[model samples]
Target: MSTELLAVRPDRSLTDGEAALLLELLPPERRERLLWQAEQREPLCAYGLLLLALRRRLGWRSLPPVARGPAGKPFFPDFPEVHWNLSHTAGAVLAGVSDRPLGVDIERFRPVTPRLLRRLGADSAEEALGRWVRLEALAKQSGTGVIAVLNRGLTAAEEASAHDLTVFPGCAAAVVLGEGEAPGQVRIWTLEALLEGLAENF
Candidate 1:
């Protein structure tokens, strides 16, 4: 079964021209939503990275229509068999696709306290964040999110099943695969390079 994960920390901000060109490659819905998300002033758009993942993994130039699950997880209704997920922090964006179900998340390095670690049932800050991301990825996969996961929590095997995705430095990411699935190596991208690639595709 095929599995793909991607991470991109945009090396630089998009120029006006670059942004305009990128809009042309996106589906109409994404263009408007990306614009809405841009208002948050995040370094990169998760949707853009999501588009890159789809193109690179499945050779699809644009997304079909999507619908959200009960928990607000987005999926392609016409392509239910194709499992995919996306996430982003101010510093990085993550995307994944696989033959089996999958979910992913990304976060930049930050200070964490012992108190916070205790809440996550971890002994150290790094372990806490790692556990945090694993919990999030597992939550995303299960469609109930963190709150629910916190209520019932992970088993030893469930926590063990979450794999770190090697992307850019100074970020934490994890992906959870369904039964019998294994993770693929991650591919990192720069926004400038991605823009150039999109231009070539046009």
Candidate 2:
């Protein structure tokens, strides 16, 4: 399989193979849930399809039925060995998978209002905003969600210090578990390019 830096996009639709792979990973009940969501169209497509693509890409053997914790974090029963995290806002969703535990987040490149920034800010310093977001993303990936990080800010300082940060100037934002090494670089996949590649492959 070509591991040439997977760059899935917000607008690219899933191929039949991709969709089948997603269904294969989902448990029966979750399959129903995904099917129900798929019936709605548009936004769910970006979230669901990308999720399935990532799940397949990571070679998840099987997933437990969707189960939630008291804190409402989602979990899989069968594949606890694989760390998985999901985040989506406005136009896109991100799924990060890693062996060493990982978290990912994506945010559109828009101005963060000063007031909102102060309220969401993890620290008083401006430089810490990315750190805060990274921490939040990491927490989400860890199944603790932002509340855990927001509540206990100093914990997981080592993982939070993962400095492989990059900015994507497009319709969405994404963060994923890093291999402790910042990717030498990232490649962007436009919606058209992705569709063309799929077509050519077929």
Candidate 3:
């Protein structure tokens, strides 16, 4: 299965004009959800922008309807064959798309407490964050969520399926793919490039 990762850093809050442009790409039902907290607007807008990019990359004339799985995982009901996951941190947002089931998670880096490090079973802050994201991605891929998976830990199968992703600096990220799916090159796009692609396609 072909898989791709996209990451964006929106350094500033989205302007009214830009928010309107991005909101046009979202389904009507999702519009109200975009009215998030002031701090969340940028990442939320970035997530919407990523969906637009994914739609164009998949050659879909229009964005597909999204549905949630039993575990609250969002997916395309019309495009069952397409698998995807999204994550957002303080200054960035990430999206992963594949032909098979996949999950991704990103977290902004912060100093890890000794207790937290031991809980996650890692030696350093980076290692701790990486391990945390891996577990979260694994849970997301299985549609079980991190709390469920963390309580039990990764099975041997899950251990082999997880892959670490190098996202923006000061952030930790990872992706988990279905068996037999390998990760492809990650494509990082600037906000201007994303806007340009959106303008050209939609």
Candidate 4:
């Protein structure tokens, strides 16, 4: 039952294994988004699949369409009662769903370039960016795009006063799931496990 982290490919499109799994779960239009760029497409599609699967697992009829806020945070329209987050990095994307406000992040284990760091932000600024990442991730989880909620003034940092922010430095993606309650627990699973489960069900 041990789950090791799986890497996603940015350049490659979704694999047949992934595509087929998605096909079985997603409607035709939803499945079309899986083409191109693992960096963006794969994770987003996977997130959609996960949401659908979770709805089925929980016995919900359907989830609200993904929507974004002013600062580029994703949210659920139908299930305004639930909070969620989504994040994608070099090779992987992570998503978290909960009844409380939550944020999840993953960063690939790589050195931060001085130039990128300089432009991105400094200590507090970096923290703010991190917060922004969580916020944006939340928007994605809600099924909304980041641009709708992308903005400034949000602070980052693991210890920030923010509710439930989960950071996964290993893969390089951050997510924030915010709703009625802050998360009291979290479950971490490898992308491979999700894919395997998807494949088996398909």
lDDT, candidates in the order shown = 0.75, 0.49, 0.79, 0.49
TM-score-better candidate, 1 vs 3 = 3
Model 2 Cα displacement at 130 (Å)?
3.6
Among all windows of 10 consecutive residues in model 1, the one with the lowest summed lDDT is 38-47
User: How many clashing residue pairs appear in each of the predictions shown?
Assistant: 0, 5, 0, 44
| Model 3 CA deviation exceeding 4 Å by range | none
- In order of appearance, the predictions have TM-scores of 0.87, 0.58, 0.90, 0.55
Candidate 1 residue pairs in clash (backbone atoms < 3 Å): none
Model 4 lDDT tens row, 34-99? 444444455654464455446544654334466656655556666665665555666555555555
Instruction: List candidate 2 stretches off by more than 4 Å.
Output: 1-7, 12-28, 31-64, 111-113, 120-132, 164-167, 170-202
Query: Where does candidate 3 clash, by residue pair?
Result: none
Task: Sort by lDDT, best first.
Answer: 3, 1, 2, 4
Ranking 1 against 4 by TM-score, winner: 1
Better of 1 and 4 by lDDT: 1
In candidate 4, where is summed lDDT lowest over 10 consecutive residues?
1-10
Of the candidates numbered 1 and 2, which has the greater lDDT value? 1
The candidate that wins on TM-score is 3
lDDT digits (tens) for residues 42-70 of candidate 1: 32345566667677777887777767899
Error of 2 at 181 (Å): 5.6
